[model samples]
Every structure is written in structure tokens, then in C-alpha cells.
Target: MANIRPYKISISESQIQDLKTRLSLSKFPDELDNAGWDMGAPLADIKRLTRHWESSYSWKTAEAELNSLPHFITDIQCDGFQPLAIHFVHIRSKVQNAIPLLWIHGWPGHFWEGVKIMKPLTEGDGVEHPAFDLVVPSLPNFAFSEGTKERGFALAQYAETLNKLMLKLGYNEYVTQGGDWGTHISRALAHLYPQTCKATHLSMDAANPPSFLANPVLTLQHMLTPYSKREREGQSRTEWFTKEGRGYNLEQSTKPQTLGYALVDSPVACLSWIYEKLHDWTDNYPWTDDEVCTWVSIYWFSVAGPAASTRIYYETHHTTRTPENPRAVPRDMLRAYSPGVKLGYSHFPMDLVVLPSTWVRTLGNVVFERDHEDGGHFAAWERPGELVKDLRDMFGKKGGAFGCVKGANGYSQ
Candidate 1:
């Protein structure tokens, strides 16, 4: 058994100096007249951010703040993969039998995204609401966690690593919340370990329209019901993503190695690459320069380097299964329903993949669903209170998934 040890964020002084040196030497490109977001991250915004990142931002202070969180590291050995050191934040609630919940993050996002909700989740109002013993892992390559060297370490491997980590922590049963790649990973866990992962709550909705062959009742319902105003608008948003915003997806999925060079070498290139999504993906969240730099800094100082994170796209895209011998839990199967685990969804208006209620219903035995008036891709960061509230309600006394994990009702006697 791998031992769990407390961890801290402590970047070297020389490394910080080196980062400044790189930022100081950044060279930006010329922009067309009035070329706002229609083109990409604007030059003016990038320039201002770069200037601040070089001169004003203090990574030392940022590092200290991150260090204050309850962080830990443990080795998790997947079946075929070598044991790798995994970093995570684990906060337990005082409420007796508080539910154990795993919060997973995706590409361009690290475990810090859970910082805002950590307190609220673990310290719910004792009388009425539910509390959680939160476990937020920095997915293998994305942050402090070590990355794998072998290829084909796709979603299944990611899911297995996390499941083992949870079990290692003595959380025999738990619930989950995720967005972006996290949504897929959490679903994979639910599919592979239905007994262990009792329920899931997702901010990003990724599911197909119910099929006549598989879900005739749902297909009929989907066909008969008129699209809500929100659903119609959601289609337009999704279309915009497909037509205008998926260039990164193509690059990351097809040739991450080629793009990795630019990302690894140039701080400005990495900044602009992530900054564009931070700007376009959110619903006009007023981001401070420090906020932008802090986010990018994680990628810049990531354990496996930024390039390693993008390989998941290629691996997932290239996953293939033969008819004679099917994969135990196929990637596409995560999109369909898993019978045992209860599911919940929270739909943010400006999220990348905004689907209708009927379509999302096909993902699982959905017991709770909520559509917010405003929010975007990074829901926990942009709207922490709302997201935490949804989790509390989902597992509270009257919730559909209440007591889903034995002895963890998250309430005071």
C-alpha cells in the first residue's frame, strides 16, 4: 500500500527567476485593425497580462496561498501502468458520517478550482444542509501530480487511478462532481465501479439524443416535446463552438506533439492559448490580470509540463475496439446510461456543450437537474456558491441521492 503524505507548493527561487526571464523576453504579434475576439485573444489584453505577469505578479504569494490548502500525495498503481505519485487536496467534514465526494478537474484546470467550494462543502449548515468530506485530486499530468510515460493511458486509466486513490483513502463509497474532461472521467468511474461511485453531479452536459433502438420511450419524448427557449439558444451556442471554437480541439487531438513545442518553449504562446479559452468560454467573467497569470502559472509549472496534458485528447480520440473482443467499458459507453448509479446535472447557460433536458436524460438514471440563468464552462470558479448549493441539495435529507453512501447522510443528530 502506498503511504499518504502531506504536501506543499514550494517552487524554487531560481525557477521563479527563470519564469520572469522568459516573460521579459516575450515577443507578441501584430493584430489587425479592430480585431477583437472574432479573431482570438486580443493583442492589447495579452500585452497587459504579459506586462503584469512579468513585473507585478508575485508567484511567491500565490504559492503561499496554495500551500495553505490541505494537500497530500500518494502513489496509485493502475493495473498495467507503473505506480505514479498523485497530489490531491483532502478536507474532511466534522459532521458525523459526512458524505465522501470526489471533485475531478479537466484540461487547463487543476485541483485549485475546488478551493472556493472546499469550505462550504465540508462545513455545511449543521441543521438542514448536507456536508461532504471532499477529495480533490490533481489529475495525473495537469498539476502537481506525476504523469505517465507509456501511451494509451486514456480515460479508463485515469478513472482507475482516481478510483484506487479514493479506495486508498478509505472511502469505500463516494459521490462525484465534475466538468470538462472531468465529466467523462467521473462517468467512467460510475460505469466501471457502480458499487463504489453511488452518484454523480456534472456541470457540463455531454450526451447524445436518445435513440429509438436503445431508448424508444426517451426518443419518443424527445421527438414530441418542443425545444425550450433555452434549448434552442443552447443549440446556437453549440453550433458556434463547432464552427468557431473547436480549433484547439483539432490541434490537441490530432497533433499535440507539434503544438507541445510552442507551449513548452514560449510562456506567451501558452498564455494566449489558454487565455483565449478563459475569455471565450466564460460568460464575460471579469478576470483580473493576477487571476489569468495564476491560472497559466499552474500549467507553466505543471509536473509533467503542459504538453503532457493534451495527449489525453489524442488517446481518447484514437481509442478503438474490435467486434470480437470489446473493451470492458468502452469510451462511447460512458455517454449512455449506467443502471445503478444515481445521476444529477447542473446546466450552465454558456457552457461549451449545452444540450436539452431530453438529451441529458439519456446519460443515466438522472434524479436531479437544474438550469441556471447564467454561468459558463468553469462553474465552480465562476459560481461556487451556486454549485455547492446544488451538491448540498442533491445529497441532503430529501434529495434523490440522500444516504446513497451508507452512514454518510451529512447531518447532525
Candidate 2:
């Protein structure tokens, strides 16, 4: 059993003062006239946000609101790595046999992303929509969790840590839900520990084009079928991301340390980097200054420091540079089929990478899929109700992944 202890968001007064001090002295960058969002996060918006962060945004109040949830810390050590003080929100359902659902978040996101759907997913009427025991973790090197000093703590290590955490918590078998890095991590979990990770519900998806040698039928189907309006739009969206929106990805993947100096040293540098994603990633979801501050604050004041979060991009990409590489098997297999775990996906039209149904089906035994007309990258945060509904429908008695976890049918006594 793991030695678990209760945890809280305890940013020191001095830390808060330092953050404010940085915000006060931030240097503003000039923007070209009529540049709009194409250039980046608007100068006016970042300036206003920086001012609000320095003045009106209360870290104490934000910390209290976050502390209201059940937070716990435990040491989870992966192979060849030192123990990480993993921070997670473990909320159990009243339903005795509720499904254990591990919600993994991606970059520019933390455990806070699951806050909106946590209670709703746990407090459901068991018969109508099965309840879940949610475990939302701050991945090693993010938020309040400790960072790893080793060179190669990639996806497999991440999957190992979470799997060990679940088993330590007495959940030998469980399902998963995630997007962004969450999607990749959950896929890693399924690929590596298929017997332990029974099923997965993903909000974001990435897949290689089906080849004649690998998926002849899928390729033929794709070739014959004309893309639907949504699929066409999704392709355009994907292209836009590939061409215009990938600068951050390239920098983070190839040379994170170069950018790390900026992230760790300047509060405004961190804010502008992430705030741009908040604006562009979502489908016109109006962001409050407070909301933006809290999101960025989690990164700014993260236990490992904001710079640690960016290394995941570098490590994962470098370790899995080639498909033949065995060190990171999930990188290749994530897009390939997984026979052991059941799969479900929620496709938000405006998500970063959206593909036609055939291309996605190559990943696994996809038992459920829902295509949303709206919403974007942050499915849980932006459209909690819809994301929750999709979960229920996917895991309900009539749905595909029902009773996947042994002895936990996601029902009340």
C-alpha cells in the first residue's frame, strides 16, 4: 500500500509577493498594427491580464477554492527513477462498485482541468449513468508534483508511475479518460499495462494515415468515402495547426532548455506563452481575467517550477524518434491497434487534431465515439456537461465498455 497523505495548495506569502513583483516589472512587447491574433496573444490582452494578475487576482482566494477539493500526495517511483511526490485528487463515489477512472491531463493543463466534472461524475444516479471514482493527478513535473532530475523520464515512465499509483490505491483494474498529453499517457497506459488498464475514453486523438499494407480495408474505405463537412473542417483545422500553430511545439520538442530560461525567469513570458493557447485552442470560450490568471498561476507557481513542464515534449519526442525504438513502444503503438483494452473517443470539432472516423478506428477496438459540433481542446473544462454525458453513454449498462472493470460495474449497492 502507498503512504498517502492529505495535501493542500500552500503557496507561501513570499512566493506570492515574488510573483507580483515579477508582474510589476514585466517588459511589454510591441505589436504591429492590425496584426490581431495571427501574430500571437494580443499585446493589449496580455497587458491587461498582467495588470490584473499583479493587482486584482488573489492567489489566496484561488488557493482556497482549489484546496476545497480532496488533494493527496504520495511517492510513486518508476523504474530507474527517484521517487516522485505525486499530487492527485482522489474522489470516491458513494456507489460501492463505482468504476475507477483515471483522468490524465496534457501540457498547459493540470489536475485543475478535471475540477468541473469531478463532482458530477462521482455523484450520479447509478442506474441511469454509472458513477466513477476519479483520480486526477498532477503529472510528475507539473503543478504541485515534484519534478524528475533524470534525463529520460518519458511516456513509459509516466505510464508506470500512474499504473503503480492505481495499484497502490487498491485499484488493480481501471479505466482512463484524457486529452492532450492525457490522450498520449492513457494510450501508453493501455498499451503497456493492458490487463491493468481495462478501457479508455479519449477527448483528443492522433493517428497516421492508414496504409495498404497495414489497414487495407480502412484505406480503401477512406479512399472511397468523401469527407463530411465536419471532417473537411477538421482537416483544415489540422493543417492550420501544422503550419501556423506548431512553432511552440518545435521549440519545446527540440530545445526546451533554451525556452526554459524564459519560462522560469519571467512571469509574463510564461503567461503570454500559455495564454495564447487558451485563446486559440478553444472555440470562442470567453475567458475571464481571473480564470486566465489561475490557469497560468498553476504553472507559474508549480512545485517543480514552470520550466520542468516543457521537458516532457523534448524527452518524449527524442526517445521515440524512430518507430523501431523499443524504449518507448507506446509512441508507435498508440496509433496502432490495442487488442486488450476497450476504446472510446469524444471528438470536439475544433480540437487540435481531428480526423475522419476511419483513420481513428485503426487505433483500437473502438466501442464508442461521439462527434461534437462545437467545443475544442479543453473538453472537460470547456464543455464539462457534454464530456460527462459522453462518459455516461460510453460506460452505461447499454454502452460498449460497461462492466469492463472486474467487480466494479459502476453501480450503487
Candidate 3:
């Protein structure tokens, strides 16, 4: 059994002072006369955020709030990789039979992403909705978790780490919820361990248009079914992301090390890089300066450093590609059918990749799906209420995935 020890976040005073010092020394870049978001994070917004981050934002307060959660660390050794100290928040519901849920976060996101939905999902009247015992982890190379020095730590390695963590916690079977990199990782988990990973829920799933050769039934359904107004609008959003917003993906996937220098050396550069995504990705979600700073602070002071997070993009894309290897980049396989593990999707219109209903249905045994008109990529943060409701509905008594996990129906006795 892996030794699980309690953990607490404690960023040194020197690190705090150094961040402020770097912010003070940051050089401002000039922007076009009217180049709003289209040109990138506006100079004015970055300047304002920089000033707030340096002058008024409080890391101590945020750290305190983060530390209040049930933090723990354990050494999880993935195959062929050194043991990494994995930081996670494990909150067991009072309901004895609550479903064990592993909520994952992707790049530019950490374990803290589950903050909003943490409490609500874990506490519910047995009769109305089911409760969940939530385990939100800082993936290796993100947040307080340690990074891997060796290469080839792709999707399979990530899935392996999380699976081991769940097993160590005595959760032999579990379900997953995630978006962004979370969606990909969860899909990988389902594909790799269909028996243990019983069900999965995703907010940002990616899938190609159904082809007659692969999914003739779904392809026929896709051909006959006219795209809904919302699906059409979602395609437009996806196009905008593919054309205008995918430069970061290309850079990070191919040349993360080059970009790492900027992220690690300059706090301002790191802020600007992530701030653009936060601004562009969400659906007009109001962001306070403190909130923005706290989010970026987690990255700025992450155990593996801000640059380490970008390597996931590179590794997932560049890792060994083989038909037999389950760990290989899950490009076509994740979209392909995987039996046993039930699936659910919570579609948000403004997310980076928005696919039509019939298109995503080919992923697997999709039992539940919900479409929302008013959210973006960060569904857990932007629309926590809706996301939580979807989980409850999916696992509730009337839902398709109810009682999927053996002896853990998410309902009270």
C-alpha cells in the first residue's frame, strides 16, 4: 500500500516576495489602437491585472482557503517513471454508500478547479439526489504534485497514476468527471481500465464526424439528423477555436521546452499566456482581480512550476504511437467505442471543442447527456451549478448510471 500522508500548502515568503519583485520589473508590451481580444489579452487588462497582482492580491489568504480542504500526498510510481509525490483533495461524503468520483482538471487548471462543486456534490438527500465521495488530484506536473524529469509520460501514465491512487484509497471501482485534458485522461482511463473505471462524465469531449465505415448506424443517424440551431452555433464556436485559438496547442504540443523558458523566467509572460485563455475560453464569466490572481498563483507557485504543465500537451502528442499500446496518444481510439464503461456528456456551447449530439454519441455506451447554452471551456468553474446538477441527474435514482458502481449507489440507506 502506498503511504498516504496529510499535506498542506506553504509557499515561502521569499517566493511570494520574488513574485512581487518580478511583477514590479515586468515590461509592458504595446498593443494596436483598437486590438481587443482578437489581438490577444489586451495590454490594458494585463497591465491592470499585473498591478493588482503586485499591489493588492493576497496569496496567503488563498493559500489558507486552499489548505482548509482535505489535502494529502502519496508517492505514486508509474511504470518506467520515478515515484512522484501526488497531491490530492479527498473528501468522503457522510453518506456511506456515496459513489466514489475522481474529478480531473486539464492544462492551465489544477486540483483547485473542483473547489466550487466539491461540497454540493458530496452532500445530498438520499431521496432526491445521490452524494459523491470526491477525489480531486493535482496531476503529476501540476499544482503541488511533482513533475517527471524523464520523457514519455503520456496519457497512459497519467491514467495509471490516478488508477493506482484510487486503488490505494480502497476504491476498487469508481467513476470520473473532467474537461479539457481531464476529458482526454478520463477517456484514456475508461479505455485502459474498463472494469475499474465504471463510468465517465465529460464536459469537453472531442470526436470526429461519424463515418459510415466505422459507425454506419451513427453515420446514418448523423446524415438524417439535421444539426440543431445550438449544434450549428457550437460548430461555429469550434471553428473559431480551431482557426484562431489553437496556436497555443500547436506551440505547446511541439515546442513546450522553448516556451517553458518564458513561463518560468517571467511571471508576466506566464500571466499573459494563461490570462488570454481565461478571457477567451469562458462565456462572459465575470472575473475579479483576486480570483484571477489566485488561479494564476496556483500555476506560478506550482510544485512543478508553470512550465511543467505545458509538457502534457507535448508528451500526449509525441509519445510512442502504436496500435497495440494502450498508452499511445488516444486520437482515434478515445472517440471509438469502448464497451462496459457507461458514458455521459455535459455539453457547453462555448467550450473549445463543441461537437454535435450524434457525432459524440459514437464514443461509447452514452447513457446520459445534457446540453447547456451558457457556458464555456471551464465548465466546472464557469457553471458549477449546472455541472453538479448533471452529475446528480446522471447518478441519481432515475438516471442511467445509477448503481453502476458495485455497492455504491450514491444513495443513503
- Window of ten residues with lowest summed lDDT in model 1: 321-330
The positional error of residue 143 in candidate 2, measured at the CA in angstroms, is 0.2
Q: Which lDDT value does model 1 have at 341?
A: 94
Supply the TM-score for candidate 3: 0.98
TM-score of each predicted structure versus truth? 0.97, 0.97, 0.98
Error of 1 at 307 (Å): 0.9
Model 2 C-alpha lDDT per residue in residues 1-413, reported as the tens digit of each score:
44999998899999999999999999987889898998998999989999999999998999999999999999999878899999999999998889999999999999998899999999977878899999999999999999999998999889999999999889999999999999999888888899999999999968888889989999999999998777889988999998899999999999999999999999999999999999899999999999999999999999999999999898888775355445474356677788889999999999998899888888888999988899999999999999999999988888899888987875623
Runs with alpha carbons beyond 4 Å of true place in candidate 1: 322-330
Model 2 scores what on Cα lDDT? 0.91
RMSD (Cα, Å) for all candidates, in order, is 1.6, 1.7, 1.4
| Candidate 2 similarity to native, TM-score | 0.97
Off by over 4 Å in 2: 320-327
Scored by lDDT, model 3 comes in at 0.91
Ranking by lDDT: 2, 3, 1
Can you write out model 3's per-residue Cα lDDT over 116-235, one digit (the tens) per residue? Answer: 999998887666989889999999999999999998888989999999999999999999999999999998898998889999999995887888888899889888989877698987
